[model samples]
Structure formats: structure tokens, C-alpha cells
Target: MVTLEQVKHQCRIDHNDEDTLLLGYVAAARDHVQRYLDRTIYDVAVPSEDPDGVLDNASIDQATLMLVGHWYAHRESVSETSMNEVPMGVTSLLAPYRHIGI
Candidate 1:
């Protein structure tokens, strides 16, 4: 999971005033990645009987970071774009984690 501090560092935000905003972005990025992968990255509320299905892959981490950065940078924009509209760097990072099954 990408931490708020890491995102903040990537964004070069050296103050706590935007901590709440940054946190929301982190969560959105995680959820975005989860949706893109069509799977959960953390084991949250799954049944204990089922094996924990957390994915700790570096690609997911990087993708989440890329997403957080993009959203943070474009927060002021008011336009709707497809999820695939993300930058190529983010898309490439997430390509390996994409679900290929129908």
C-alpha cells in the first residue's frame, strides 16, 4: 500500500495542510488500481476461511503512486476521461497487473 507520506514526498508537499486531501487521493488511487486489476490488493473484509488475497506487487505500488500524482496534479481540471486516459507511464506500470481473463 502506498502511504500518504510517500505520495506527499512524490508531490513535494512539505506541509500537513493538505494531508486530508492527499489521503483521499491515496485511497482513490488504490481503489482505481483495484478496479483496473479487477481484484483487491488488500484482504480487508474477506472471510477468514478464505486465504488472504493481498497483492504486494511493486507494479501495483508504482501504479498507485502514478495515479495519486496525476490526480493531485489535475485536481482542478473539470473533464471526464476514460480510466485508460491515464499517462503512458502509469498505464505501462499497470499493464503487467491487468486481468487478461474475460
Candidate 2:
């Protein structure tokens, strides 16, 4: 996986700096959403008769947007300033889902 900083570096000399970085971040965040859902729903919710249906209603894309919205909304509230903060936010956002256990 490519780091956000590395992507930003690649896009630094481009004409659209902020947009490029933002797009990369969005893609990375959405990928995180997919991986998180896959892990929490399939791998973690094991031994169940119907795990797929359990997560069928999950909308990773929408959830990713919400996560990004919340990040921008409360950027100041999050004490951590590093890139790890995004994944940390993702974990917190998905905490409620983890307890579902299919």
C-alpha cells in the first residue's frame, strides 16, 4: 500500500496540489473502508451460516464519505496529527460494527 505522504510527494510538483492530494486520500480511505468491512464482516464473523447477508447492507463508499466528513468536521478534536489518525478514526468508526459478529 502506498503511503499518503508518498502520494502527496508525487503530486507536489503538479498543477493541482490540493486536489491531487485530496483525491489520493479519498481513494486510500475508501480502500481502508473496504478492507475493514471485509475483515470485520467475513474473517471475524466466522462460523456463521450466512455471513455475506449480514454485511450485505453495508455501504463501504458511503461509510468512507462519512468518515472523511467526520475527520474534517473534528480535525481539531483529534489530538493525533500524524497520518495514523485516519486509520485510528476508521477503527473507531467501525467499532460498532465489530460487535455485531454477523
* Best model per lDDT: 1
> What does the lDDT read for residue 62 in candidate 2?
42
Sequence-dependent TM-score of model 2: 0.36
Per-residue lDDT, model 2, residue 14, is 39
Q: Model 2, range 5-102, lDDT digits (tens) per residue?
A: 44344434234546554665566666676566554333234446655322522444345555555544454655655544545454666655543444
Each prediction's TM-score versus the true structure: 0.75, 0.36
**Which candidate gets the maximum TM-score versus the true structure?**
1
> What lDDT is obtained when candidate 2 is compared to the true structure?
0.50
What is the C-alpha lDDT profile of model 1 across 13-93, one tens digit per residue?
989999998999988888887777666666345455535244557777888888788888888667575454645677788
Ten-residue segment with the worst summed lDDT in candidate 2? 52-61
Model 2 misplaced regions, further than 4 Å: 1-17, 39-58, 72-102
lDDT of each: 0.75, 0.50
lDDT of residue 40 for candidate 2: 34
